[model samples]
Target: MKKSLLLLIAFSLMVMGTQVQAAGQDIRLVVDISGSMNRTDPNNLRIPTANMLADLLPDGSEAGVWTFAREVNMLVKHGLVNDAWRDQVQEEAEKINSVGLYTHIDHAIETVTWDADWDVDKDRHLILLSDGLVDLSQADTQEERSRENQASRDHLLRERLPQLVDAGYTLHTLALSDEADQDLMATLAQRSGGLHAIAYEADDLMPLLLQILNRVVDSEQVPLEGNEFSIDPLINEFTALVFHQPDAEMVLHSPSGESYTRESDQSNLNWHGNARYTLVTVKEPEAGDWQIETPAHPDNRITVVSDLKLHTSSFPATVYRGFPDKEQTLKAWFTEEGQRIDRREFLRLLDAQMQHHQDDLLLTEKNMPFAEDNLDFRASLTDFDELGEQQVTVLVDGHTFQRQVTHSFNVQDVVAANLQLPENGGTPKIVLRAQHPQLDPDQVDFQVTANGEAQPIDYRGDGEWQVDLANLEPGREYLLEVEAEGKLKGERLNLVLPSMRLEEGSVRALDRQPEEPQETEESQQTPPDFVPNIAPQVIPSPVLPTPSASQTEEASEEEQQPAQSEEESDPPVDDETADEEGLFEMDFSPIKSWDDPRMLWVYVALGLANILLFTLAFILYRRFIRRRKERHDAQVHDDEDTPEIDDLEFDLDDELDPGK
Candidate 1:
């Protein structure tokens, strides 16, 4: 029993080790297809570089390809790396044409970061290639447009990049040209715990890509143990020193002789570890030799973390790509060193030319609201129908932040085939319309099958084809299978029409009909009379008396007297006779008061008061005007009489006297 137990334990350990080794890494290659890439890389070596990288990747690894120009496109989705997949990827890479108009780095990164299938338990990496900074130029002048474009790209990078880093995804960047934003690329790589490389020409790209891939795939830890050892780091490069034994006391001396013990609080050093191991990360290490000393344990091991270091896992990766007409949302939460920063101003959208095009501005609904919380600022984009590149700019604390994006307006081919029935109850037919750019009308052929039997179709000119369904039964569902072939190779299309019900009264239409109300036997039966179960009305105890005939007659008489008096007091005037006598003139009798028999006197007094006020205003206005004129004349007279400061006295008199 003891021997059997030992064998079982050993088997279990072997299985666990196999499982750990089987966990694979996910790597995505993101390439730039912008117009600038075509200019910078005249040899068009990106495709070959990508193919070479694919060849170098280890078998059974997960890898994918994504490209960005004015927009992002996933040529090969993430899948297991095998011989077939590598060949397929190579073919797709060969098809990549440098026809895109803009460099949308943010969109490309976001696409891989968000859209790709990322396995968190396994290692994840994003290899980015770009020839230049994000270009969103819509400006007339190159200088202004470039400035705006950089600002927009910077804003987007700052806002969306931290999410990738925070998610634990390492980003490796390859700068493809001299104009590439080296600082930004390096910053992105460092923040994401990755590496950045620069390629001055097309020749340097493939080798660099291969080197990075090899480092990631074949990374091995080098053990170090000694009293004194030298460590050198590249200038402005991130370096890390890891001690395997947590209890080991170590002292590190910088090139400047600055000594740092394990407990030293150095600004550039970020320390984190446990009992098993301790790690120290130095940002932008000094470009000189450094020394380490550990007196505690002879068994202590030191590991160097440099550009060749590989990460096992990274942050969730995603990328966004779509047509220009669709709305895109960009979100970012502002924070500094884990503290929220609420100093953002506003976010704006620019066209491909990097100009302030009002038509391309983000929709009001997509605007990011300024708030003090840690919630993300979101902007909705719309009306970016201009083909090629666009940009989103966010203003943070008076600094311009920007991101370049691309879009396409290409519409895919659509096959519109539907069943139509005659309104007069004749043969049902299938109507077909092919909406494809490359479809040749003469070469287009279609076959229809219903209920596992072939159906006859009549070809009509002008790209219209139809199939008769007279043999099919009416008011019954039938399955339809349609096969269509276009002129281009591999342009075949197959469509299975939904089960459709035929009608005897008319031909069945493709559009769905509303369900008619059903009449059941119970509903058809007559409804019983709705008898009232209400209680009887109650009678009042005291009833009011009805008016007598005399009282009613008196009320009628009183109402008639007013009408009679009004008629008797008023005189009847004929309108025609009154017009001749000028009796239609305006009347002032209504304004005549009871105390004053005539209102004419009041009107006369008002008219006099108005005249007096107007006379006074006019006199004052004239006097004011005269005084202003006199002041203007006086100033003019003074200006004319004033002598010039440069005039010299007696110079002309002296010259004239001498000449005479």
Candidate 2:
């Protein structure tokens, strides 16, 4: 009875877990198709950076592409990610690289985020390749400029960028020019925890890609069985991780038994659906063949299919069990056909379990279907659709906060609210029923409340759902009561709670509101008016000595008197909107913003200096290279005319004279 009770309790918690579609660290590489990445990335040999990325990805490491010239374009037709997706990516990338279009970095980012159906959980990897400054020529006035700046900032921040932040896919910004957005790149890296690389030319690409791609998923492997009947690891898309060499060549076999090795002879191979067999060739031959020969082991052999992975590539049937697990070790790598599968010794399950335990990103390899029978599933919130209506934005400390959604459903179906009592327990039984316009209020299913109050919220038009909180105290207990068609469906939707957070703007506004008391009538009264003579006073001249406190006070009063008289003589201008025009930048309200033409000259002067410096460097480099080439050529010609010298040659007096 105790064992059965414990099993029931263990099963309960698993049912209670929420099925939220959390973010993943899937990466999308936005390559610069500006006809430049095609010109060999000098860092990664002659291979283009695009191709390098394609090669570097591990099997099942999901990747997407966004190529940009003047406009941003997605490589795939939709969201299909497989080996065949490469052709589309390569084609678009090639077009982008070779085409000549004005580079607009801001536009590219905006297009991808707005048009390409950005995945919140996946890391956004954007590569901008234009070699120029961000053109904000559209902003001509102060107002326009402010709006432009706001648009630029909002273009990236318009959506709550949680998916990017949590996934740690900061932009791995690779720039071909020194003029790339270094600050923006740094911001993206800092926010998303990605890398930033600057390649001034194509030659500096291969090394960069190689450096990043060195980390293969599950690079370490060990044998489970002996040198004969062995087991090893091989990762593919879905179906073919077989027992072979620790790093074996994956090949496809036809039903007739014809085999073809993987095009890329790498251990971490990308999986395709065409593979039919896992062929493990042996280093040493003739040992296992003789043992299983003829009638000795016709029925003793067993066939098992094993396609284990350390990544998220979804191919069919490669993940689940096919063979008897690797725990039962044998002397050699043997196939179920009784054929000696060679080149490996062993395969173990302990290591596979270890890998599984370590992989926190992917919970499990199998896309296990949800079973409502054995598990507890709930929908606290449902039918989340945003319409263009009264969208009330809440602010906290001057910062915009997430909008809270209140939803109400008609009780067409009755469900049981299996709410558990808190530690300092209160009520034992609770039930909730819902009624909508289409359903009868009398025949409602369940009632949900923030507190223990019987008064439930009602649904209003335009998606307005109301719930009474009279019983709710700040940070207190509540229960979601449910009852469906007189019989409760399940306690799946009861554990709902509110997520309340203060906006930064609200906090700031609270801080900025004045806390001082208003001025009183007596305090508001001005200082007594002092009448003073404007004309220079003619008085008795006296010998000046260091003045005493009273004398100094009188002198200061006399000095201030003239300033007061001048202020009274010329009353201050009351116009608050006017400023004395000066020789500097000026914005004429809604119309014009003009910087003194002298500022243009300042830039011209800077440009001239840059030109001079560039010319000087170019000339110096040419001279040095030219002189070095001349010396090399002269040396080569002189070497051709000279006789060869060897260490074995004797330096006789006769030989020395001839050289002289």
Candidate 3:
């Protein structure tokens, strides 16, 4: 049972670890689709480059493609890198034929950095491929618009790129042409701890992209010592290099039995430092293993660089300043050929250097048995007391196999600034507090503005500033801008604090009011029934007089009686004319009382119905009482007839004898 429980726990942990590693990668490919690409590229290399990138990316990695000219359009939303996604991305990429007129590089960067769907805990990368010719002109004029656009692009690079870096997104830049902005690209890459590479022509783009993808996916290194070394590249366009022997003769054989020696085909082979190292470039290499033969120096190592990946436990942004004697550990590792090399002597042979402020700091390898798959090394820094803009560099030894990585940390005495606003209405008072020991109270300057207009600021003692907002209008927004200038570690510091807005009330009103419904002429007109003057008065018809029973009987009997003489009938004609005259005149009189015998009979019937209802109700109540009494009597009888079981006794001895 214990073993089974342990196995179950281990399985759960393994599944969890797989889930953590398989959180997948998010990569945004921001491509330039301006009209200039048509003239500069001519061959339409961007589409093919995107295709190569999609093919090279690891399966299940989510990627999004964005193209920016006048505006940015998403070709492929972030999705898993399946075969269908690859095909879809390739199709959309083909549609980008450089038709747009303007290049909005700033807009593209802002959209990808802020608007793109990013998984915060997962590995996120932004691969920007542009000519860096940012043209944001949308007006009729040219020169003035160009200047504004250039300034906007410069501001984006200076401000937004740092924010992206601080948010922990690595941005890799690829400059496609000689006219591309190299300085901006390098700055972006360096600040974000990403690699920056240049492509002089269209052909160099694919390899540069492949290198980036490899860094994101996996990296490995294989040491070669024998006369014959073979390497199997599963993917096409694999880069291989053999280093540390200048005079060694080398021969390479393709899988198709084509041989390439130092003297035969030297086009693909590039030598560094007088044939000290050779870099072999294989374009669309075969699937089978390729052999490399070196005659001299069998012990000399040939390091096969597959992918270059740097993993650190604590990044530069995470490092904090401590006391002068306080010791802090910096752990880092590098992966090559998908394997972790934690050997101390092997790491020492690489000659890794860690420097801070032009001083080389010594780093010792730290063994981490719990992390078997990660190569862990630690460096101790004792003098972190000097604060403000500290940087460290880590690099390997050889030129061909060397990796130069630098990370910067801002060591400040004050980590954050605290600002307190007044609660009541009056001249607004703001209290500025510094959280660090070295921060001076007098160096901070606070300026308040109401609706873009500056207000008078009165500086009180001990980091407090009072702004006279007495003349300022209420129910309006006021902005507070704070500037803190101080000196730390012999470096001048000018910091612009976060802008804060204050309104008269806790919640500010919306800028615009909701539109109200309009009243039409037809709606305003009231109906004739609703208006007293125009209302039609309805006159009711007169009620007909009911005939007496005797009169009705006399009329029926007269019809059955024998007819009188013509003279007797003629006497009734005058009476009939009088009846006709009476019928033409209607009696207009109010009904006073109902004194007819039929009305008396109706009142008598209603009284009889009320008495009948009362008698029926009385009968039902009597029946209910009688039934309830009978049920009570029956219950009493049942209780009396039921005998108690406790009173009855059994003869156990007699019963036992009868069974035997």
Could you tally the backbone clashes for each prediction?
A: 35, 74, 9
Better of 2 and 3 by TM-score: 3
lDDT of each: 0.50, 0.32, 0.51
Clashing pairs in model 3, backbone N/Cα/C closer than 3 A: 219-336, 219-337, 219-338, 220-336, 220-337, 220-338, 221-336, 221-337, 388-411
What is the alpha-carbon lDDT for the whole of candidate 1?
0.50
Instruction: Give the best candidate by TM-score.
Output: 3
State residue 263's C-alpha deviation in candidate 3, in Å.
29
Tens digit of per-residue lDDT, candidate 3, span 267-380: 545322123334455555554546676553421222333454444544333233432323555566766556766666556555445555511233332232222344454566
Q: What TM-score, computed on C-alpha atoms, does each candidate reach?
A: 0.31, 0.30, 0.39
Per-residue lDDT tens digits for candidate 2, residues 1-660, read 999999998887665432111222244555554433333232322224455455334434456666665467876443434556655555544444434233445666655544234445433454433333232323323234334543553344324233445434444445554434333433343334344444555544443333223221112122112211222222111222232322444544322344445563545334431111132322212111111111221111111123321121111101111111212110111122334333222221111111111101321121122123422111211211221011111110101100011111111111112221111111122222221112233433344543344546454322123333333332333433322232112212222222111121110111122122122111111112221211112110010000001111112322221112222322134465334533342433221113333346568999999999999999998996576555544555774655346311333523454532
Q: Using alpha carbons, what is the TM-score of model 1?
A: 0.31
Off by over 4 Å in 1: 1-22, 115-119, 137-151, 219-660
Write the number of the candidate with greater lDDT, choosing between 1 and 2: 1
